[model samples]
Target: MAEFTSQGGILRGQDVVSILFPVAVIPLLFLLRSVFFYVKARSQFPGPPIRNFWVGNLDQTMANDVHEKWLQWNREYGPIFQTWNSPFSRVIYIGDPHIITEITTLNWPKSSAQYAGFRPLSGDALFVQTNHEKWRIQSKRLAPAFQPHVIQAQRPCLAKHLSNFVRAMDVVAEQNTVVDLSSLHILLTLDFVGDIAFGTNLHAISQGRDCRILQLFEIILPELMKCGLFPLRGRFPILQKTRLMYRAIAELRSMAEKAIKDARQKGDEALGTSPRKKISDILATQREPDESYTFSSKELCDNYIAFLVAGGDPTAHTMSFLIYQVLCHPLVLKKVRAEIDANIPFDTTVPSISQVNLPYLNMVIKETLRYSSPGFGTFRVCPVDTTIAGVTLPANTTLALWNPAVHRDPKLWDNADEFDPERWQSGQPKVRGSYFPFSSGPRSCIGQGLAMLEMTMTLATVFRRYDLSLESGFQMEYLPSFTLKPKNGLLVRAILRKF
Candidate 1:
């Protein structure tokens, strides 16, 4: 009886070990596999990372101002570094001009996962096209519409919007009330882009209120910045189908379709009406000269929405930064205002592009773009196994070209942190990849001319008519999102000039 009892106890012990073995081995196998992949992906490229086993460096990047985090990392790791997005995914950040020039000038395809968020809104638009050949053809067809002469035609529309913006500021100046200039810049840009893109005066500037589309964009942009950049919310498809996102997408689609329809119906009547050929007309009529390529109605809508979103956000943010930076430096403001006063006449409506010859004003704008570096960063992916900066990068690996790091590198620029507009006086100091606010090469921003025009025109108009001062106790912080925006808003007191 004693021997039989001992045998049963041994069997029971064996049973317990059997039950626990698989559970222990499963996680161990997963961990080993993860490590193997991580090691394989991160071969040779070095980074400064305090990494978590599961989330990698993602936790460190999830913050209010993540781009600043990138700047910090750049300082620690030098210009080129590898960062882990997940245990299995490696991202390389490159700031070297040679690498950047090679990637952009070669027209590298964008990583699908990295740019996936833009697709739901832009829908394979020119900026977000995954097909290299398609984008090339589309860019060619759309080139005429954005030529210097064509963009010049929009000056009247921009001038009209600036006039409205100035009048609105006059009210706040008279009241001696502090106004959120960031929000106002958004409103003004929305109105300007509205006229130029859809040929509609949205009156966002005149009313000083957020229109439905603008409100929808405000909601959509943050959601995208959250899920698209980090992808935590994107894990669940249900969250992507939220009502607010649905509404914004639907409304944007509707607006684009209507604009396209209107342009098609009106034809030359529509074409002749705008100060220049509007983006809507351009989209509606644009095709390959040989008719080999033409945008479908869906493509038209996508491109139009792209224009509205792209045309407004970065320009607005840059303008806001320009104003804020000038306000912060009283001497800079005095010089810029003096330049504007000397060049731009007090009652000049639709100031000719040539007429606004303020070299100092142009310097201020360029310097502001560099200081703010508002487009965030350009992302590209290696289409095939390739080498960049002497480091081997596997196919499909994401490469981040962060402008702020490049723009603020002390090695690249003397006193890089200091806001010096004089640095840009000699035709923006050719710095190769170092000074690319609009990015560079084939995939650079198409609406850059329009943005520059709007910013310079608005700056000249405002500085000529008003004296801007930062609100007391107001601290400016960078609100890094899809585009770098001013946190809260740039509150300022605008005192109308009697000149």
Candidate 2:
């Protein structure tokens, strides 16, 4: 008989060995895990002990606002910290300008897995694209679309849209309704992007909840973000093949392809039906030029779909949140409106893009961008073993720099918490990497110019004719991911100015 039951079979010596072996091995495995985590962590720069394998801060990460949490960590820890992703993965959050600049130096094909997150949906649009020669070739080919004269032509259309927007606002004001301006702004921006992409308005501006376009947007964006945040599932490609994620992706792809096919057919009809009068000339320009770049009809479809997703939502969220910040400071709102009226009259039928350079309006936009950046920070995995800012990091370490934290660094900007635009103008040390509302360097937003113009112009038109105010019951919350947007919506009240 044995002190412990050995139903299978156990020799006299084997019973003792079997029981002792597990007891010895279990602690050893734990010791090894702890030792590895500790050695790798300490070998780098020092940081808070909060990052532990057992606690798994991803919960804390998902729970608290990363923007606030990052700010808190910077206050507690220094500018640089070494953290862990899981049992054996690494994550770094860099706040120093020099470190960030080195990482964003445009390694081209050597760029990070960020491209992978968007590639499934976007394929290879300029945003979320890292196809070395493909992007360069396509970018050069597409650059003609944004030339001075070509971009100038769109001004007429944008101005016309802005007038329609003003009229819409007038109606909303008359109703004395509490408007979630964020949702409204998102719809308006969606309309603008869809119009430019397909040469007609999608009429998303007044559409209610669960519209096809909005539904498709929610499907793609949240999943794409989920894929990025928790990519363990993606490290194994077979997991993506499972029905769990595949169906979600299929829905987004179906909608994207349908939109693309629709746009292509419309372009074809325009070219075939009226060669001399191309409806949206942007479509006509998609054809290959001397093989500098040639896009398949499918590629054209994907590109427009990509632009719609990338360009529309971020700008809408930014514009909406900008107004929210403006609401917080009625004095700032009044100042911005005064600048708009002085420069471009409230009833102005149309104004040149150059006219949006009104001082306070520009200040407000700059402040808005700083106060609430649209897109959150992105990640990079080292191509090979590398040390950054005294952190000896190995390849495959995911490095992320939280811009929201960097933007609010008191060491970098004055009254970091306060909504002050003067800091940008008043000899503000030109803080490096301090304010990358749009991610900086070569990979910075290619559509920054267009988005900047759209937001500034639209806001100019609205503030000039409207006395902006938030309703008593207004509230806002942010859901951070690829871009930052209000969770429920941005509710506000507005009235027409005496002007």
RMSD to true structure for each model, in Å: 5.3, 5.6
Report the lDDT of model 1 for residue 390: 83
What does candidate 1's lDDT look like per residue over 228-266, in tens digits? 554545444466444467568778788878877776677
Q: What local lDDT score does residue 92 receive in model 1, on the 0 to 100 scale?
A: 80
Q: Candidate 1 — worst ten consecutive residues by lDDT sum?
A: 1-10
The lDDT per prediction is 0.77, 0.67
lDDT of 1 at 27: 100
Q: Write the per-residue lDDT of candidate 2 for residues 3-42, one digit (tens) a residue.
A: 5446876467667888899999999999999888667665
> Model 2: what TM-score?
0.82
- Top candidate (lDDT): 1
